[model samples]
Target chain A: MRKFLGLVGAVALLAACETAPTDGANANASGDAAAQKLGPAAGSAQDFVVNVGDRVFFGFDQYNISADARSTLEKQAMWLKKFPGVTIVLEGHADERGTREYNLALGERRANAAKEYLVSLGVDAMRIKTISYGKERPVALGHNEAAWTQNRRAVTVVTVGAGS
Target chain B: MKFCVRFLTLAVLLFSSQAWAELRVDITQGRVEPMPLAVVEFTGDNSDAAQIGAQIAQVVSADLERSGLFRPIDPKAFIQKELSMTTLPRFGDWRILNAQALVQGHAVPQANGELAIQFRLWDVNAETQMVGLAYNTVADNWRRVAHIIADTIYQRITGESGYFDTRIVYVAESGPANKRVKRLAIMDQDGAKHRFLTDGLDLVLTPRFSPTLQEITYLSYYKNTPRVYLFNIDSGRQSILGDFPGMTFAPRFSFDGTKVVMSMARDGNSDIYTMDLATRQTRRVTRHSSIDTSPSYSPDGKSIAFNSDRGGSQQIYVMDSTGKNVRRISFGKGRYATPVWSPRGDLIAFTKMTGGKFYIGVMRTDGSGERLLADGYLVESPTWAPNGRVLMFYRETLRGEKKTTKLYSVDLTGYNEREVITPLEGSDPAWSPLIP
Candidate 1:
C-alpha cells in the first residue's frame, strides 16, 4: 500500500510537469497579476482557451494526437461550447527539422488532426479554419529537443470572438 | 542584329578550322590545381575604347579565375607586350612564364559607335593557335562581350558549356532572425549589377528564373496569405498567380515555360498542381493525401521530380508530366527534398537531412550513384548553373545564440566549394540560362 501511494504521487508529479512550459523560461514570468490584464477574461474566447490551454505538442515528425493532446482538446471543446458564435483558427507549426515545403504540409496535417478531434467532440466543423506556418514561425529559438518539442505545436487561436 | 550575324559567322569559321593542339582541362579531377594561362592587355583604337578594352580583359580574367578551372597569370609576368591580333604570339615566352595557354585580343571602335573585339587562343606547348573569333556589339554591351569571349575560351579548353554569361535570382535577407525582411534580388553571375526587385514589405522566398530568363516565379506573403507570384523582371511588373481555395506555394516554371507546377493546401492535404500560363487552365497533378511539393520539371519536359511524404518519410519521387507512372527515386537513409533536375539531364540535385546534418547532393535519374557535395548545420535548396557543372545553395550556422545564413556553391567533383558574396543574408538562389 505504501509503494502504491508512492507510485501515484510520482505519476501526479509527472502530470504536473507535462503541463508546465517545455522551455526552461517561464512563459508568464510576470505572474497572475499582469497575466490577468493581458490574459483571457471569463466568458471570452481568450478566457476559454487560456484557462484550459490553447495548444498541444507532438513528437519529432509525428502529428497524431497524443493522450495529453486529447485531454487539452476536451477542455477546449467544453470551453468552446460556452461560446457558440466564436470561430477558431487552428494554426499548426513544426520544428526546424525538415525542408520548408514538407514541414508546411506536416503542420497542416497536425492542425487538421486537432480540428477533427474538436469536431468529434460536438464542435461545428464550419467554425474552425486551418493554417500551417511550417517551420517558419518558431516561438522557441533553441536548436535542441526541448525547444523543438515546444515549437512542434498546434495552436488554437480564437479568430472571431468576444476579444475581437 | 548585323553584329550578331557577323559574330556567328566568325565563330563558325573559327570553330571549323580548329584542328590544332587543344588545351584540354580534365574537370572530373576537380580543382586540385588551376590551369595557368596568360591574357595580354588588349589594344584599342581610341582612348575610350582603350579603357573599355582594359575593363573587358579584366572581366574575362575574373570569370575564368572564378570557375576554378583557369588561373590567369599576372600581366606583370608577361615577357611579350601588346601582340597584334594578326600576328602569332611568342609561345615560348608564355611557356617560360609557366602559362599553358595564351590569349591575345584587340578592341576597335566601329563607325556606327559599336565595338569590334577580336581574340585568339593559343596552345603554348604546341606553339599553335587553337581558335580565334571576333565580336561586334554596342559599346554599352562591353561586359557581355567579355563574357562571350570568356565562354568561347572556356569551351575550347574544358570542352564543356560555359556559364559566364548567366544571372542568378535569390532572396536577400536582412534584420534579425525573429523578424527578417526579405527582398527579391538579381545580379550577374559574377555578382555585378546587384539590385532588388521588391520593396521588402512582403516576405518572398524561392525566386526561380523562367526558361526565357526574362521573368521570375516565386512565393510571396501577400496580404498575410502565402501565394505564388510572377514578376516580369524586364518590365518591373509584378502580379499574383491564380487564386486557389487555400494557401499555395513552392512554385516552379515548367521546362518549356508554358506552365507552373506548385503545391496547394486544401482540406488539410497539400498536393501538387500545375496551371497553363497560356490558357489559365488549372490541373491537378497528384491526388495523394501526402504533402507533395517542390516539383521540378525534367530538362526534357516529359517528367517531373518532386518531394513527397507518401512513402512514410520525405523522399524524392518522379512521375510523368501527366502525373502517371509515379515511382520513388530516393531510397537513401535520410529524407530528401527539393530534387531539382540538372540542366544536363544527367543528375538530380537535392537536399538531404540525416544524422542531424543537412547535405546538398546529387544522384542519377534512377536514384543511383548518390554523391554529396556540401554538408552543414542547415543547408538546402540546391540550384544549378547553366552548365550544370556547379551548384549553389544556402547554409545556415548556429553560433551560441545567433544563426547566420549565407549563399555557397560547389562543383560536381566536390571540390572548389566557396561562399558566393551577397550584400546580406542570401537564400534560395536560381541560376538563369545563358543570356542571348
Candidate 2:
C-alpha cells in the first residue's frame, strides 16, 4: 500500500511540472472565492453555486460528509438562506472506481447528504432537487487519484424558478 | 453412428469403400492443445452451389478457429485436393498432415429453389466418420446453415453446446472523451452482421436481450431522464418499462423472459425492482438504505445476485426472488460490483476493484472459488456467452489525456483472450442466447 502511494506521489510530482498551470490556478481561485463569499449575500443562487462553491468532495467509497465538506455546505446553506426565491438542483456524482449502478446510487446519497444538511440549516426542502449522474459526467479526465478525488463530488446547480 | 452403418451398407452393395472407427481426440478435459481439424472446402454440385459452398465452408472454419478449441489446418497443407463428400478421405494422407479430425461437405441445388447442405465429420486416426448431417434451406439463409453446421461439429468434438450462432448487444461509443456519443449496437458473436438499434440522439447503456431474442431491455436517457426501455429489434418499436418517479437503470430480463429486473433510484436511494413485461406490474425486490443495484436473476429464477454497499462497501449479495433471506456472498479484500449470474446457474461474474486496478472475475454463487480472468486499468461489465464457457467485457486504456475502450472476450478458463473487433469504441456488452 505504501509503495502504491509512493508511486502516485512520484507521478503527481512529475505531472506537476509537465501540465499547464491553468487548472491549479482555477482550483485555487474557486476555493478562495468560496471562502470569501461564505457570509455575505451572494445575490443569486447561481452566484452561490459558483462563488460559494457548489461541490463538496468525499472519501473513497464513502458518502458521509467530511469536515471539509461540512464547511463548504455551511457556506452553501448561508447562500441559500439569503436567496428566498432561488431554487437549486443538487447534482450527485462519483468516481469511476465503482460500478455504474452503484455509483449512481452513491451519487444520490452524497447529493442528499448535502441537501439534508442545508435543510437542517433552515433551507426549504422543496426548493432543492437532486439528481445522480453517477460517474458518467466527469470534470476531470485523468485516471489518477488527483482526478478521482475531484470526480467523487456533488455539485449544487441553480435552476430557474417557475415564477422567474 | 447410424450414418456410418448406412454408408457401409451402401458401400458394400453399390460401391467399394473402406471404413475404420477410431477415437481421434480425447476431450475429457479442457483442450490444452487445440485439436487440429482439416476443414476441406465443400464441393459444389453446380456452379451456383459451388460459390455458396465455398462461403459456407469459410464461415464454418472461421467459427471453429475462433473457438480456440479447434485449430482449422490450412487447406494448402492438404496432400489431396478436390475432396468428394460421398467417399472417405485417405487416413494416411490426413495423418501425414497432423490433422486429428477432418470435415468434408458438399452443397447441392435442391428442388423448390432451395439449397441442400451435407457435411460429414471424420476421425482421421480412427479412419471412421463421426457425424453425417444434411440440411435444406433457402439459398439466402446459407450463413445460418453454416452456423448450425459449426454448432454440430463443436458439440460432437467438445461435448458442450456451442455459442457460435449467438449475437451480442453493446453500447457503441465514439467522439471525443469529454462528449461521447453512444448508441445501442448489435452484431453476431463473430462480430459480423453489425447493426445499430438506436441513433446517437439519446445515450443508451447496459442492453440485455430477452430469452426470446426478439426484444431488448436497456437504459436510455429518453427526454433526459434515464429510464428502462423495452425495444423490439425486429419491429423497431419501443416502450417504457414503467413510469418511475426517479431514474431506473441496469435492466436485465429474467431467464424465463417473463420479468425485467432493474435498479430504480428514488429519494437518493437505489433498490432492485422487477417489472413483469407481460402485465407491466412492478415489484420492489430489495429495500435498503444503501445502494443495491445491478440485479441479475439466477437461471432458475429462484434467486437474484446483486451488489450492495449496505455493509459499508460494495459487495455481492444474493437474495431469494421475494427479496428475503439476503446473504452477503463476497468477502474479498476489495470491492465487488455488477454480479451477473452465469447462465449455467453455478457461478457469478463480477467486477472487482482493488489496489487501484479493476478485474473481471467469476466466483461460485456462495462467493468461493473466485478466479480473476482479466485485469486492467479499467475493466468491468462482464457478460457471459450463451454456453457459459466464455465471458465478454470491455477494457479501457489510458493514453495520456485520452482513453480508449474496446470489447474483449476471454474463455472461462482464463485463456484465449481476444478483442471483439468493432468499428468504434464499445462498452457494456451483452451476449445473446443462441439464435433459435
Candidate 3:
C-alpha cells in the first residue's frame, strides 16, 4: 500500500519532457481553450479533467492498471491530497466487445481497482465513490480497436463543484 | 409470459396417416427442406371483416414463412383463388403446385364488436382436413388472433408446440455509438405492435420477462445509480426490485415468477443473489471475490446456471438452488457469459467469445455437446423462445462502419437464422414466453 505514496512527488522536476498519448501538457493544451469558457479554476472539476489527469486507460478487457496509468493516478492523488474537502466519484467504463452484464461487473472491478490505488496513495476511502457504466457511456465513437482503447477507462469526476 | 388460449380446442386429427400420405414438417433434423404451404387470403362476411381478414392472413403467412419450416407459396400459384369458409379447398389445385398443405380461413365481425376467425388446415397430399379451429377476440386484437392461428397450424404439422404469439422486450438503441439513447421497447414475435416502455431519460439494459405474468425484470441506470427494476407491462408501473446496499444488475425471473435472480457488486466484487417477490427478502447465492453474474434458473427451479470468472476467465457454472454443489459447466476455449437455461430443461444457451470472435451457442445441461449456432463481430445475450426450439440474441457490426446493434434469432439446427426487425438499433434482447 505504501509503494506509490510520494513516489512521483516532483511533477515539475521531470520538466514535462515525455510525450506519451496521455502526457499532461498535451491534454492541458486541448482543455486550455475550453478552460477559458468552462472556467478551469484551481481545484475545479474542469481543472481536474483538463490538468490533473482525471482519467486513465486500460488494455482490452483488462482491468489491471498500466504503467502509463500510474503517472495519471499519481497526479490524481496529488490533486485529491491538495483539496482536503473535495470528494470525487470514479466512473469505470468498458469497450463494446464484451457481454453486457459481465462488462458491467468488469467495469466495477476497474473502478474499484482505481479506488484501491487511490487509497494506497493516501486518499481517504470515505471521500471516494465508484460507479460502473460498462459500455453504456463511451468516450470514443468508432467501432475499431483504437476507439475501444480509449473507451476502456476509469474517470475521476470532482464532485465538490467548481467554486470550491 | 404465459399464453392464454381463449379459443376452445376445436381441432382434432380426424383421419390417420395410413389412409393418406403423412404431411408433416420434420423439425428435429437439421438442414431440412421447407414444406411448401399455400396460405390463402381469408375471406370475410363484410367489407370491414374483409380488410381485417386480409391483414390477419398476411400476418399468419409472414409468421409461417419466418419459421423456415414452411414456405408460403405465392398467391399467384393458387388455381382456386376464391376460398370460402364452408366450402372445402381444392386439394387438386394445391397438389398441382406441389404445395403439401393448404390453409383456408374466414373472418366474421360480430355485432358485439368482437372478431371471430375460423381456419382449416388441409393436408393436400392426403386430401383431408388435418385440423380446424376458431378464435374469438376483441376487434383490436386481430393481430394476436392471427398469431394464434399460425401457432395452431404449426403445431398440427410439426408435432411440437409453437413459438408464435410471443413478445420480446429489448433495449432499443438510437443515436451514435458514444451517445446512444437506449429505451425499453416491446413488440410481438413478428415485430407487430411496436411501442416504447421507457422515455430514454435513463439508460436501461437486459429486459427479461416473467414466465407467468406480464412483468419484466431488468437493469436500469435510474438517477445515475444502476440497479435492478421490475416493470408491470399491464399497468405501466415500475419499481426497484432489489434494495441492496450495492449495485444490482443482470436480473432474471425465476421459473415460477416468484423471485428475481441477479448479481450484486459490493466492495468491487460481484456475486449472485436471489430475491423473493412476496417477502422482498434476498439470499446471497454465491460468495466469491471474483465476478459472478448473469444468473438464470432451470425450468424446474432446482438449480441455477451463471457466468463466473472465479476460475480466472469467464465460464458457465452450475449450482443448486441453495448455492451449493458449485460446478463449472463450460470448458471451451473462449470466455463464456449469459448462460440462459432453456424452457425444455435440457439445454442452456450462451454467448462465447473466442479468437476475437463472438458466438451464440448451446450445450446440454451438463455442458457437454457444445454446438456453436451463429457467429459474428459481436453477438451476445441469447434468450430462448417459449418452445425452447429457437434462440434470440443481438448482433453488432464492429468493422468498416459505425458500430450498429440489431436483434437476431437462430433455431437449434443453426441453418435457419433470421434477423428480428426493429424500429431502431437494438441490443440486449429478452424474449418472453408465448403470450396468451
| The candidate that achieves the highest lDDT relative to the unseen native structure | 3
Off by more than 4 A, model 3: A1-39, A161-164, B1-5, B8-21
| CAPRI-style class, candidate 2 | acceptable
Q: Chain A only: list TM-scores of all candidates.
A: 0.75, 0.71, 0.75
**Model 2 lDDT at residue B123:** 83
Model 2 quality (TM-score): 0.87
Candidate 1 residue runs with Cα over 4 Å from true position: A1-40, A43-50, B1-17, B28-32
Docking class of 1: acceptable
lDDT of 2: 0.82
TM-score of B-chain for each predicted structure, in order: 0.95, 0.94, 0.96
TM-scores, each model vs. reference: 0.88, 0.87, 0.91
True contacts kept of 2: 0.59
Per-residue accuracy of model 3 over B70-185 as CA lDDT, tens digit each:
99999986899897666666778888999998888887777878777878888887778877788777767888889888998888888889989889999999986667899999
Rank all candidate structures by their lDDT, best first, as comma-separated numbers: 3, 1, 2
Clashing pairs in 1: none
Residue-wise C-alpha lDDT for candidate 2, range A1-164, written one tens digit per residue:
34333433443344433433454455564676764554223465434533566677787878788777787788878877776777888888898777777887888888888888889889999999888878878767788787888778888877764121
